[model samples]
Target: MVSKELVLKAEIRKENGKKHSARLRLQGKIPAVVYGHKQEPQSIVLDLHDFTEGLHHGHKLFDIEIGSNKEKLLVKEVQYDHLGKKIIHADLIRVDLSEKVEVSVPLVFKGTPAGASEGGILEEHLDSIEIECAVTEIPESIDVSVKGLKIDESLHVRDIALPAGVKLVTDPELLVIACSKPIEVAPVEEAAGAEEPTSPEVITERKPKEGEEEESEKKE
Candidate 1:
């Protein structure tokens, strides 16, 4: 799914430091930096709620407005709190709509596999794949149909069908998904009659001492 155009408002940040960033977060905002396109990096602040909501909706490309200036930017990274539940900071890079960019697109498996009805387990090896496409043509996620796969069947990166302008950047031989027969475990009852081998007992004779032997000979 390709994302719809997403627009956000940003403001230039004059101060830098952990304290200032913490203060911003307290106001429901996030510290961010924009760089790329041979331009100097710009420190900016974005609304935490709006940016988080956009991300939850799978937005990657954004049109951010700063005062009278507007630029297209792509999400580069998002830092979260130590608990990984809160957004801390974000990084965005400038992009041109006309240029091609490489990004990782999520995979969505569709339908139950045919192998599932046959007592086979369906395994997913990859959750996302790297792809190259026009910035404007970036997809939210790629759909992979698993209904056609039968027992012991598999799908590789090369088997996926992408949008017209999208190209796979991952290795063609990488395994994407597979359906395999479930492993069969032997029942414990079947081992009841099996006898475990026991080690044989060993015997050793002790030799009589020299003085004892001589005394015994005299008695004889």
Candidate 2:
């Protein structure tokens, strides 16, 4: 998959303390640092919305323009607030189109597994995998199909098919997904029924009076 291109307009930051970073955030911008590949580290800030929008659309490669200088950068990490409701900071690394770069690519599963019909539960262990490949050959996401997978079977990192230039940085023996028998869950209703309350029943019947019974026998 190819990522949608996103352009971020950034301005070089002159300050580098928490107070200054707070001030930038108050102005609706996020503080960030860009440095890698023997390049000069630059302190910068960009619009919070611009950063969030690019991330939401899965744009890994960022085209950052600082003043008259423009360079292609890659998102390495992002720090979030305690509640994870806000973006606190971001780490950007300089990238060269001709060099191989390592990045984490999300895995997308396609199709239903045959084990699902056989009452087997499917579990996904990893959502993304790290790989090193040329900048131009990097995929937005890796696609893994779960169709025809049987119970007690699992797929590992080695099962993934990668591009010609791409190499898996994660361990090949690491489990990605698996199909197994459903775990046994205790039956709540059965347990509740075992301790059911038992209440006794009462019955009463009325008898005829002696005088009324004698009159009825004489008339008969």
Q: Rate the local accuracy (lDDT) of all candidates.
A: 0.94, 0.89
Cα lDDT, model 1, residue 10: 99
* lDDT string, candidate 2, 32-134, tens digits: 9998989888999989998998887888889999999998889999989899988989999998889989899999998888899889988999999999988
Q: How many backbone clashes does candidate 1 have?
A: 0
CA lDDT, candidate 1, residue 209: 100
- Give all TM-scores, in the order shown: 0.81, 0.81
Steric clash pairs (candidate 2)? none
Give the lowest summed-lDDT range of ten residues in model 2.
Answer: 187-196
Top candidate when judged by lDDT against the true structure: 1
Q: Once superposed on the true structure, which residue ranges of model 1 sit more than 4 Å away at CA?
A: 189-220
Q: What TM-score, to 2 decimals, does candidate 2 have? A: 0.81
